[model samples]
Target: MFKAKNVIRIGKGANAVLARPLSGIPLAIWAFSLTFALALGSTAAQQTPPPNPHSPPPTSVTHQMYLDMKLGTLNIHGDNAVVEALVLQRDIPITYDYVATLMRTPNAFGEGPACIVCHSSNDQLKSYRGLNLSSCEGILLGATEAPANPIVIKGEPFQSHLIQRIRNNRMPLGTPFFAPVDTDSILAVKDWINAGALNDENFTTKVLPLFVDPVAFGSETACTECHKSFRDPPSFNEVNLTSYDAIMTGAFSKTRKKQNLPGLPIVVPSNAEASPLYQRLTTSRMPPGTDPGSPADHPNTLLLMRWIEQGASCD
Candidate 1:
């Protein structure tokens, strides 16, 4: 460990500012960071090169390895076609819909019954983390619902918390100890996020139905269970998720400032990970009495992201 040292100024006047290192930086750590910064001229991700379709998926197919492999070799000229081809190369097409299928499949990884056998059950709140993997919308909301830390950070898979948890063996959490999922599945998902985590179909087809489905939130009641004023609710806190019109015109009233509760946005078009409403369902905060959701949970946070990514459109 590099011990903290007071930085010394070597030059007089304004040149001292240019010559000296910042005070709190540890020399070794600073040097290491600068070595890469100087070599790359920017964080490696500043160049969002699509994966080379012909290149094999890394034997260790996490985002970090992907970056290092590409950057070390200076192969940074990939394009949309390459991204499409690379992520689509697996036995399966990686998209929100496929993830939902895996969520519902019986004994998906030989660890236990399908994830939804438990996560989607009404009783999930009693034993599990309260994430409802029942639909694309719920999945996009993510498990933790932590706003600042999104489950899927599009175009930057390594930064996504979902990838972090899976690589660390912390998800698919259930009986049989949430063993590592298949390597192919993990790689496919990572590449999908790195490629902007697009939806297989339109938002209306994949996500809008979820807004009206009661069971999607692990509750018999739908989002309409609360906030009935789709057009004009009485309070600033309540938002209308009842219709496409209401949802698009999120918080129709500017009277939100006067309300006692904090007026957070329900949906942010093309950015579901940042939307508090999506975060609410993913963290299992809705339907009453579950962990307060944040946009941070991984397993429960991609479908809605795709919806938002697709412009949060109705049609």
Candidate 2:
């Protein structure tokens, strides 16, 4: 440790300041150095971090904030301030507190008990299908150890058995905790799982805006330019790329209907290769002519594909 006194040569007058020495150093010099050191320490301790506009507010609720930032009320998912608050942070956080809340909150409309009540496991009680919603680990580990049909498919929410049950009106046992498990709630879970079923709330805050933000996107063609609604009439295929919710909520495909199958989701959370949006950029190039546009590994197409791999957060 470099002490100020060691580096500082006392002036010739030092002997006059305090003739008596404490240990070896003069008492007056020691006192002055101690005072200065305390002052510096105090200043450093009191220093506030440079304002981080992207950090979540102390009073903000993660679940509510997630919903608020992605309500789909406007074409832009959230205000710039709110979006920045969720992004631009040192390290994106991971938490499933909101999902836990979803499982525990009593159903206002349904006569049945909360999801947790029936899905939890304990010495005295065990839910059917061995599903346990009481903890994050249990949910991710899923119902059966290795069922023929898996419960949660990590990056594929639609394929997850849990979502399938809710969508099919088979969950919560009785009247159902959320009537039909409100679209918003189901979407929340979908976002949760589609994000590789992790707790990173940044999964929604940091990614997905690339679709509309051409500057950040680093390309002449913005995906939202053609995909987002608000055109003269409306976007082709009714696929609104305006926000996270819109992109995740894909448009119907006649091809799938012809085969009596469901259409593939445009952006499948953490799976870009499986996403049709990426597929178009690679095969059957999207922007039509231009001698067939950018290649599959083109920077622009790779950008979109990469976004999905990062959980495709909308705001």
What are the lDDT figures for the candidates, one per model?
0.41, 0.42
Candidate 1 residue lDDT tens string, 1-315: 122344332223422211122222244544443333234323443556666779766674334434563464322221121222222222122455545655665523222356566556323344244556676655445554323233555555534444443332222111123223334333333343344434544344545565466655444545565554633444223566565555544553445546754344455655544444444443322222222222233222333334334433233
- The lowest-lDDT stretch of 10 consecutive residues in candidate 2 is 73-82
**Candidate 2 pairs with clashing backbones:** 54-85, 95-199, 207-313
lDDT of 2 by residue, 33-149 (tens): 433333333333233445456866546444433333233211111112212233222123323543454456453112234677667863223665576768766776676533323
- lDDT at 44, model 1: 44
Candidate 2 yields a Cα-based lDDT of: 0.42
Could you tell me every candidate's TM-score relative to the true structure? 0.26, 0.29
Deviating ranges (above 4 Å) for candidate 2: 1-94, 108-111, 122-125, 145-149, 170-252, 255-315
